[model samples]
Target: MARIIGGLTTSHVPSIGKAIAQKEQESPYWKPFFDAFKPAHEWLAREKPDVAVVIYNDHGLNNFLDKMPTFAIGAAAEYHNADEGWGIPVLKPFRGHPKLSWHIIESLVADEFDITMCQEVLVDHAFTLPMALMYPGNIDWPVATVPVMLNSVQHPLPTARRCYKLGQAIGRAIDSFPEDIKVVLLGTGGLSHQLDGKRAGFINKPFDLWCMDKMRNDPEALARLSNHEIVEKAGSQGVELMTWIAMRAAMTGRVKELHATYHVPISNTGGAVMLFENNPQPHAIAAE
Candidate 1:
């Protein structure tokens, strides 16, 4: 059966894309954040997962405020990157695993989660930047991908608990697939930072660190938090952390923290990169 090999998390701030385009990774302001990915790169080299299920939020690129699904999955043969007006150069399309995507979508629906199925989807920076960070300079990505997007941009968003459950469902789905493939989960976006409103440019390091710790040691507590509480503590945009929570849930096995690093003020956001290994085992869900 297919199994999860590991999981990854990172900040997908638009400026990070621009930094790569400008070759500014080693620059003073970006060096620390860029350096964090080295260990992740090494881990990727060692494991070489066959597919990546990227969990991210669309920033008005594919889904807009007027109409957005609470959750969406890409089932296309190829996923493309577009000019989202962030001045980040467009990237070549990433190959997709249509078979796996369809299996996941069917499983999710059977598991009773409403899901948007997209045969053709445009991947924004949230999806692309994280891929670039992991597989730097590989214009042609090495592994097939499945984009799992959450609606963090709109209100009435899925609660932390709901997102965690969604991840659990995804994990179960992948585990049942007949293919003997290795999968990696990528949860992109947020450590903490708010843009717009009076609290624009707001970031809470203490809360960010606490969330990261809980992600490794006590994700159940983190999932218990309400959307209002997360926004209040993490800032409005900080709700992006839901993607990370979902990724963690998908591990569904013995999880070990391989490496993690956090840096602040990356394009007015807290930037973080984390890698975790998922050793196969019996499926288990944390108790509420």
Candidate 2:
């Protein structure tokens, strides 16, 4: 059976992408950010999962305000690294696992979770930046991917509770698949920072750390947190942490946090990265 080996969470700030593209990872300004993922990259190199189910939000790239789906899954054979208007150097086309994507889509639909199926989609910085961090210095990504796009740009976004439940459904789907595949779940974006209005340069370190600790120790309590509460405490952009919650909730039992990195003031964002491996045995406590 297909098994979920682990999950990851990271802040998807666009500036991080710029830092990587400029090859300034070893420099003082970018060293902390890049150095943080070194362990994760090495771990990934060893684990070598067959597929990555990335949960991220679009930033006005392929998903404009006009026709945004609350949740979308890419079933395309390959995905293009489209220019998100501002001329960020595009990466090579990312190979996709269409069969697994379709299986997830069918499973989600059967479980009553409405999802937009995309046979073709242009992935923006939200998706690519994390990829760059996770697999730096690679010409092509090692594993095929399944993009699970969540709505963080639009209002009426899926709540934290819903995202967690959706993740549970996805975990079940993965377990049911007959292929002997290893899967990784990635929750990309946010540790608290705002990018618009008068509050553009906001960064809440205490709140971000608190949330991270909570997620690591007691994700069930994290699931009970509402979006309004998250926004209020972690700043507006912190809403992106919904993806993190879903990624954590997707795995069974308690998760062992393997490595973590956090830095302040990454282009008006609180940058962070965490890697987690699920325990083989399930926790006896109820998921409140």
Candidate 3:
């Protein structure tokens, strides 16, 4: 059976990556934030899981307004970063795992978990930024990837409960994998900040801190949080935490945080970097 090796929590704000790619993530406010990611990066290189099941939202890049599935997975052989009006100029194609991905899809579906499977999808910065930030010099990723896209950027998105259930389903699917492997469920997107209306650029430190605390200790309470509540209390448009619910649920009410960092470099936005380990059964350690 596959084991939940570790997890990562991050924000995939496009501007953040744009700043870094342009070599500008070292400002007085942002420098300290970037510095905090070292341990998370080091942890990835050290653990080197067989696959990283990424939970991220697409900004209408691949899954357009035409048909948006609340949850989707890429069972493709590879993924390329398409120019979303703004060019990356130097990024290469992203790696993917077709066989394992197909297995996940088949398993999830067999267990009555509905998921949209994609063959052609161009990942936006939401998928690329975290990888670039975490593995900057990576030419070829040491492990494969399973892209789980959520429809949080669009209106009428999935509820926090819906996302949480999906996470549980993913965990069940991973457990049924015949091969022995390590899986990392990475959740990417916002802590607290608004990006729309006159209230744009709003930052709430208190909410961000509370979010980090709940993410580590009381995830169920965190899952109970609503998008509107997050927007009104935190910001107007950056409450993408639903995707993290799925990541959190995959752990099945068990996690030990490895690293946690929070920063608000850009005005009207907050960013965070966190790491978690999922050891479902404490005694399972001795068996390994």
The lDDT for every candidate, in the order shown, is: 0.92, 0.85, 0.79
Off by over 4 Å in 3: 283-288
Native-structure RMSD, model 1? 2.9
Assess every candidate by TM-score: 0.97, 0.95, 0.92
Candidate 1 per-residue lDDT, tens place, 131-227, comes to 9999998556889999999999879989999999999999999988889899999999998989979999999999999999988898888789999
Enumerate clash totals for all models, in the order shown: 0, 0, 2
- Residue pairs with colliding backbones in model 1 are none
Pick the lDDT winner. 1
Error of 1 at 265 (Å): 1.6
The weakest ten consecutive residues by lDDT in model 2 span: 279-288
lDDT per residue (tens digit) for residues 1-288 in model 3:
687787888887777666776787677866766777788878877888888888998987787788888789998888888777766544577778887788889988887778899997788888887877777664677667889998876677777777888888888888768788988878888777777788877788788888888888877787787777877877755667776777888885357999888877554567787889877675555555
Model 1 bad stretches (over 4 Å): 282-288
Arranged by lDDT with the best first, the candidates are: 1, 2, 3
Indicate the residue-level lDDT of 168 in model 3.
Answer: 83
